[model samples]
Target: MILLQINQVARLFGAEVLFENMQLEIQSQSRIGLVGRNGAGKSTLLKIIAGIESPDKGTLTKTKNLSIGYLAQNSGLNSDTTVWNEMLDAFTAVRQMESRLRELETLISTQEIDSPEGQRVLKEYDQLQHTFVEQNGYSYENEIRSILHGFQFDATFYQQKVQDLSGGQRTRLALAKMLLQKPELLILDEPTNHLDIQTLAWLENYLQNYQGALLIVSHDRYFLDKVVTEIYEIARHKMMHYKGNYSRYLTLKEEQLALDWKAFEKQQGQINKLEDFVARNLARASTTKRAQSRRKQLEKMERMERPQGAEKSANILFKIDKPSGNVVLQLEDGEIGYDKHVLAKNITLDIRRKDAIALVGPNGIGKSTLLKSILKEIPLLKGTLHYGTNVSLGYYDQGQQKLQPQKTILKELWDEHPTTPEVEIRSVLGSFLFSGEDVEKTIGLLSGGEKARVALAKLAMNHENFLILDEPTNHLDIDSKEVLENALIDFEGTILFVSHDRYFINRIATKVIELSPEKSTLYLGDYDYYMEKKQEEAELLALLEQDQVKEKSVSAGKQSFQQTKEQQKIIRQLQRKIGQLEENLEQIEEEVSQLELQMTQPDNLNNHFALIELQTTIDEKTIQQETLYEEWEKASLELEQLDS
Candidate 1:
């Protein structure tokens, strides 16, 4: 079913039209990704769809009783209530049903079993219990725990007041609450903000299995690829939809643009030929009729508009003034933190002359703290740090604290490079898309993206040999991020940066350093390679444990070893069975998803018999999946017990 239909939607800001003739239909389980360049009114369109803001000239028709949960970009939860209480609010109706069930129980206990009143109370209890189970009242608290844990909120945080949490934590809590609500339609605007790689992965997995439709606006390409199956791009004050994930969307978009250009060129050639013929023959007496016919053809022709070009992107290039020593940076037994509070210790890192390393860890695990420690902004708690000769370090602060708030954008870069010519400074700023009057804007008044560009402009001017960046992609849109990634990839300098953007890390990093309180592990390749290595290590470790268990059984004697071997054999069989069941269940789910998508098509919607057939197939697949799930769960438990 179409949960929402937006027809000819138009939004405006003052005299400027953001988007017009925007049409979209969200199905009951659509997974849509909204993407565009910064300031292209993607968020404005989301607000219009979410019904948070009205469109200047359009209408939104929603399904009756449709429930929507909207989380604006960086919109944190603000409440005096504790975290547990805030989450509980999402389950008020279920909780109310539980209360009534208790009341029914009480009435049943006080009356005779043979009486009509007693039987009525029992029926009421049974009905409420059924609804309670369907609504997940029994498992809701556990669901809350699982979601909060995924967001890195532990049991200890349950009692904490929302006001007491940090801004980022509050934003996470808001998202957590939305997930708990499980609305029919979930509309998120930049929901990935303030999330670490680990949290982003968890969120992607959660959203993949989410029942409701998702309309997400995220610059995280990897997340979008994993979560959303459709892409809606808003560019040049228009919205266009493409079927597929982010990577597929890119491919389709490029092909479309190429095709559009070809058609436009073909039409332009025809138009040129027609005009030339009309001009040459219109004045000639011998071809006057033909010329008039050509003119008429030209007047009636539906001219093809010129194909639009790629949107403007920031031009970022990192240059080194001179070559640095082979060893760009070295940290030995580093203990980094604020004063005596150490966040991570026993950290040892050796950064080479041209290696781009990505520092990764969970949020608040001290990725930024380590960067600050290396810069000597804060003293290293318990170790030595060194920079090699001829290494000029340029830092990009994620918070933009390095910028002079009172200074203009022009002055911000010019002051840093006082010897450079005024025209040269303006030219560089213009490359970053700060042209004309935009250069006069104060740093404090500029948006996050603008400040990021200013920072990049400053970094470019320094021509540093070694760059230490902290979440450098925080405020950049997708286009700007790709530009920055290309720049960093082409840079000759050594780079050590902290970023939660997996796509960015995959693009630019030659190595990855994972931080933990216990120790640091170094991976020799990018983010994807790091994950692969981690999985291999985990499997290896599990195998080692199994071997150790076998050795222990051998130590017990030959008869015991035989019994242990048999048990292990059974465990392996059970594991294989569970794996087969899981694979079958996955196939069934995919089939059901395809069937549902088919049901949403215009042709199938108009064909009543087709819709019923598709839905019936989906229902059968769902039932089969539930049975497989039960078998998988039972086998998994047996395997777990045997392994234990």
Candidate 2:
């Protein structure tokens, strides 16, 4: 059954047309992943379908009883409400039903069907009760609570109000509410923006089992693959449908592009042959009519439009300056964190020119703080920071610094560089997707996304060798992220950045430094390779534990004789385990090195979702490796104790 049908949709912002003559149909139980460059009218189209916004020209049709639930990119909750209360609000209908059911119950016991007043009350009561039960009014709240817990909403968090939670937490809560509403079609915009790997996986599972249709906009390739069964790619002012996941979409797209090329080539060949025949034979009496016929045919033949130029997206075409020196930036013997907590201590860092560094950490572990420390905004408490020769610093603050209240958008950008020409400046700003009237908007009036674009426009001004970026992708739509990633990938200078966007990190990071409560360790590779190394480490740990158990069993036999044998066995095991860890570590490191090099290639970033999964798997591996190493050390010490 068709859940919803959108036909010939057209949305215009100013003079630019978002898309025209676009058509898409949502089937029952279908999952569609909507993808396009930023500013492609995806959100606008979704709103038109949801009846939240009107399209300039379009029609959205849906079946009767087909309820729709939409999740906006922003947190859709009253600031003062508690997390638990917000979820319950999703069931406004159920709340009404419950109240009505209670009222019916009061009259049910006393009313008789035969009495006119009693009959009226009794009939109304029975009908309301049936409707309540049909809607499953009783269990919805309880079920939603379970789902909230699944999304990492602990019971304690339920009492915390919306105003107290982080933006990420609010996004998750909103997701939970939508899940509870149980709409016929669920439209989620940038649903994975603030989600962790675990919560993302949970959502994937929930959606996979969902009976209703779903359409979501996300840059998380892994989440899209795990949930969406179809993809709608909006580009060149048209909607193109693909039959499978992100991988399949890429594969099918490549094939289609190839076929399109071939078709154009074949048509050209025919046109050329016709032209040759006409040129030679047009003067001959017998061939005059034939030439005329060929000319007519040529006129009727439709030529393909040339594909957009190779570097069509960005006009400036980012080119980075050469590295200044060996040491770009370094932190020595540093304690980094705010008051009362230390993020990383007894820490030293050595950064070299042209080395792409990815700053990674869990929420609240202070990756952002560490970035701030490098900027010297946060006091290092007890550390010396150093910079290399002529190392001009270009900063991409996580908040995208245009976030600071200012007069106008143009002024926010202009404040950064006073000398840049207005024409050149606007051209650079346009490359980041800000155009015309957008440059005039006040900083206080700009959306988070608009502010981010303005910040990027400012960053584009500095031709610095060392770029310090903090979540450059936070507000960038997928298209802008890709453009930014491509630019970074092509950049010749050094980069040290923090981002929650795994897709972007995998494409550019030459190294990953995971900031943990225990310690910050460097994984010298791209996201995918890191995961592989971590997996090998986990398996090695598992094997080590098994071997240790076997060694203990052998060590348990006799007092004197067994003691000597046990000691000897212990020596061999220690030697063997140490050798194995060394070997395992080397193997992972080697693999990571190769993968890191491969990630620099353009083809590697093509499948962004694959990279995300690879990162999540790597993170799990790193944790397992840490646990194994701790166990191995403890066991080795005990073996020494037994030897004595």
Residue 437 local lDDT, model 2: 85
Q: What TM-score would each prediction reach against the true structure?
A: 0.84, 0.70
- Residue by residue across 145-216, what tens digits does model 2's lDDT show? 679867887656777989887777777777888888888899999888776544665778888998789988
lDDT at residue 209 of model 2 (Cα atoms): 92
After aligning candidate 2 to the native by TM-score, how far in Å is the CA of 152 from where it should be? 4.1
lDDT of 1 by residue, 16-81 (tens): 887888888999999999999888888888888888889888789999999999999999999999
Error of 2 at 180 (Å): 2.1
Give the residue spans of candidate 2 off by over 4 A.
Answer: 12-16, 56-58, 91-146, 150-152, 164-168, 196-198, 275-285, 299-304, 307-311, 315-333, 339-353, 382-392, 402-454, 457-461, 531-644
Q: lDDT of all the models against the reference?
A: 0.87, 0.75
Off by over 4 Å in 1: 110-123, 546-644
Model 1 accuracy (lDDT, Cα) = 0.87
